[model samples]
Target: MNQQAISDLITKMADDELVLGHRNSEWTGLGPVMEEDIAFSSMAQDQIGHALALYRIQEEHMGGPDPDAFAFLRPAAEFKCCHLVEMPIGSYDFSLMRHFLFDHAEAVRYESLLQSEFAPLQQLARKLKGELKYHTLHADAWILQLGRAGGESYERMQAALDTCFPLACGIFEPGEADQALINDNIYPGEKVLYERWLDNIYRVLVKASLNMPDPAAITPAYGGRYGQHTPHLQPLLEEMGAVLRLDPAARW
Candidate 1:
């Protein structure tokens, strides 16, 4: 197996989790209701925990930097998270739509990773699957409820879906080592994962009476995997790393 490919894959996955986890954390006390507030906070913890685990895999097995230093000290240009996660947690509708789209994508990715040739990733994928299952369930339930509510709520959800779908598609932007990972069975490659993700989300969207934007007509917001990002990312990085930057020696 090509270790570089494995490391690249893991780094991107870890970055995605860490960035989105922070985005989720932004909702800690801001959720529309008490239940949602607790739910987002809990999921934020899960995502950050998942990111820590993946970063440790890189440090322990892939000769990468320390997890804290890597996560908190890396420049924005070095991070590999997709545009979807980097976008601010917008309104509740937008955030919920993003959560529905993103968690399902994560579900498909980890499901495929269960067969990875890399033992560490395969085991981690197994552990993460159960958590992602609930994440998707929470997203699906909210999407269905608001989508069927038939008022401003329904309209807002539809608008949020339209806004989020293209951004969500960016999550599968191919990595540099994708072909190597595919050849060595470290992963199924982004194309296969993208297809599976579409299928997986389509089932739930249909049940929710939501219209998925036609992919053929949508240009996915890409470039993040290659170190290019929306202007939003750098500031997010600054805020995320501020405390650690102030005191690099501080321990959690």
Candidate 2:
């Protein structure tokens, strides 16, 4: 297996979890209700934990930077997370739709990673798979309820889905390292993962009575894989790394 390809894949996954985890943390004390606040907070912790785990693998096994340095010190252009994760949490509707879309992709990606030739990733994927089950459960329940609940709830959810679908597709943006990873069985590739994600998400949307947009007709929001990002990412990174930057050498 190519170490650079493995590093690329791990860092991208870690960056995605870290960014989205920060966004999810924004919901703490601001959710529609206490239950949701707790749920988002819990999931945020899970995402951050996942990020930390992957970063450690990079550091230990791949001779990359340490977890804290890799996560807290990277510039916006250096991050490999897709544009889908960098968008603001926005409204409850938008956040919920993003959660529904992103987590399903994660579920499929991690499921494929379970068969990875890399043992550490395989182990981590196994643990994360269980946590993601709950995350998807929460996302699916809310989507179904609000999607069919009538009135503004239904309208809001549908709108959010339409807006998020294209951005969500960006999660599968092809990367230079992909063919190598696929060839070595390090991963099944993002294209395959995207297809599985579509199937998984389609089932939930069907249950919610939601419309499936024509994926081919929609232009996927891309470029993040090669370090391109929306304007929202820089501010988020500043906020996430603020305290750590005050004194990088200080032990927390």
Which parts of model 1 have CA positions greater than 4 angstroms off? 250-252
What lDDT would candidate 1 get against the real structure?
0.92
> lDDT per model, in order?
0.92, 0.92
Worst 10 residues of 2 by lDDT: 61-70
Tens digits of per-residue lDDT for model 1, 1-252: 899888888888999999999999999999899999999999999999999999999999989898999998999999989999999888999989989999999999999989989999899999988899999999999998988888898889989989999999999998778899999988889999999999988888888888889999999989888899999999998998898899898776
Q: Can you give the lDDT of residue 21 in candidate 2?
A: 97
Residue-wise C-alpha lDDT for candidate 2, range 17-107, written one tens digit per residue? 9999999999999999999999999999999999999999988888888789889988999999999899999999999999999999898
Model 2: lDDT of residue 225: 85
RMSD of each: 1.0, 0.8
Looking at model 1, the pairs that clash are: none
